[model samples]
Target: MVVIHDGYFTDVEGCIKENWFQIDSLLAKQILCRFSLPFNKLAIFTLYNNCVHLSAICILINLFHIYILTRKALRTTSPIYILLTAIAMIDIVSLSYDIHTEIVEVYKVFKVCYSKETDYTIILLNNIMEFIRNYSRRCSTWLSFSIALIRTLIVKYPLNPKLEILSKPKIAFYIIPTILILSAPIHFMDIYKYQIVFYDENFKCTQFPSYTTLYYGSILSDYYEQDDVWLWKLNRTIDAVISKFIPCILFPIVTYLLVIEIRLADERRKKLNQSSIAEKDSKNTTKLVLFLTLPFFLGELPIGLILLTKPIDKLREAIGFSLFTEGIEKFFSVVLSATTATHMIVCVFMSSQYRESALSFIRCGVKFKSQNS
Candidate 1:
């Protein structure tokens, strides 16, 4: 191994001091060789495999969820159910898009069906799907917060019609559109932030690129771009606020308020000796709100806080882009997928109305199959 320092070929380990820490070339080589697998391949492989399994399960369960939710008994029950259905549908679309992007990535990463020039159309479609999935995740986040706040308000003020406007599907007809409009810009810039650079088919990505090895496409993102640094920072600031800061801050406060209201509601029930089935259902609905909203908050809270910390110069400079930020993003993407998956189970376990509807749907399905048979 050759070690070059300050325009001089040296075999010494003493001059390898960088900033605060000093590391020998042997150690550095060892570090690089230990993992062996290139990050580009590792990140994509891990994300692709996990997303395939998790997204498949989430899509199937959410399809069943939407079916059960649209039952006549549950459809008109409340706007909360409407929101739940929207979340489920978006989850399906998002996961499908994720799968689409990964499929293209398999071609891009593993160098399958190579051509003279890079497949811009395929790569662009992959980027579009990535952005759309991101937007869907954000919309899901905001919708979760909306439901939490609405359920809390309805519980806190049981008789306030104006405040409960959002709790009604008719009154809040624009909510979904509003969320889509607001969160659309967050990923718009990201589309232009990356593009495929490595295109040559015969050119080995590394010394000898084969299966389970170096990356095929090496696209640089905005964080690596040196031009217009201020603009990137400004855009990232806005993204952090819209996509991370506000929702993360408000979700916990809303959760606390919702939990408090649930307890107070229980106390009210005890005081009134309200043992009626309707009162029992009301209590269950309140708990359902907690169950639905809390998962997204918990799943996203860690990553949100970490992303928020990117603005801090010291921390960001200390931990460079790919290893820390990219890894975290991939991990949390799966976390969000898993969180959405739990919604089906959450609805089934907590909402008695949903349980009844699910049973009815199951019976209808079995009867129809028997008749067809």
Candidate 2:
């Protein structure tokens, strides 16, 4: 999603105006025509399937939560369960947005002829895409960390009533708004490529931002130039510290804390081990954490390694190696998707409690339909 600026920013800076919208259907058709370009359809197909799988998994998670809410016996004051439900809901909404982009609109509009004015609809769509992309990145990072934190709390302080503060519903409600506020700065980031521009009857959006090529094409040059070097370094350093360093540090620490808590409980409670229910619960809980956390760690490693090697630019222009990079990205996305899907499968397959509850809900719906018939 990075851009390389070849000073097109200067040529178009004077053309940008606030409160303007443009949609060129002719341009959209032209863009989609490139689908005929010699590219790997297999890779594209894999990406499409990955997107569908992710969307379906998320939708199922949402359905599971609705089922949970239907079960009075299973309903409790347990904060952990509430947190899981909220996380599922968030994942569902985010995944739906992603699927909409891929299947519903690849940002293409076809018009038999060009309209003189910019399309307001496309402008609105562009803004919405920018907002969702920026905010979702921030939200997903924080939510995953929050989940890790909740698990650590449950394992570490099982009997501590004060641990109620980490309750799922409370944290879920609070964190959603907190993520929104934290991402407020994103509205001002303006660090996007392919922005709408107009100049002297030539109306089009350029991949590089007008008047600021430094933030566009070629990751290295985007943040590094002999001119304006300090601003670039400052921005790069901030991005590195927050995006790269914080998540890297936090995920591991929280994961380690969860592991230690589980071990401590296991060692301190030999009497409890005799109870089959306790042991089964403990094993399932451990599996849940391990299955979810492992992919995230694996996915994190490659990006971190690439950063350390200063390979962003090379990877971007890696024509010969581009396929390799794309493979790794697709693989990681699949790993994450598989892990998420496993969580849903666990709800139905491993947990008899959840399975029974889910089935009863389905049966009730069947009965209602039969009665109406």
* RMSD after CA superposition, every candidate: 7.2, 12.0
lDDT at residue 293 of model 1 (Cα atoms):
75
Please write out the lDDT profile of model 1 over residues 131-158, one tens digit for every residue: 7777787888888787888888888998
TM-score of 1: 0.76
Candidate 1: stretches off by over 4 Å: 1-49, 105-111, 116-118, 164-167, 195-228, 311-322, 365-373
Per candidate, the number of residue pairs that clash is 0, 8
Q: How do all models score by TM-score?
A: 0.76, 0.62
Give candidate 2 misplaced runs (Cα > 4 Å): 1-77, 102-120, 167-171, 183-194, 199-245, 271-283, 298-340, 349-352, 365-373
Count clashing residue pairs in model 1. Answer: 0
Question: Which candidate should be chosen as best, given lDDT against the real structure?
Answer: 1
TM-score of 2: 0.62
**RMSD in angstroms, candidate 1?**
7.2
lDDT of 1: 0.67
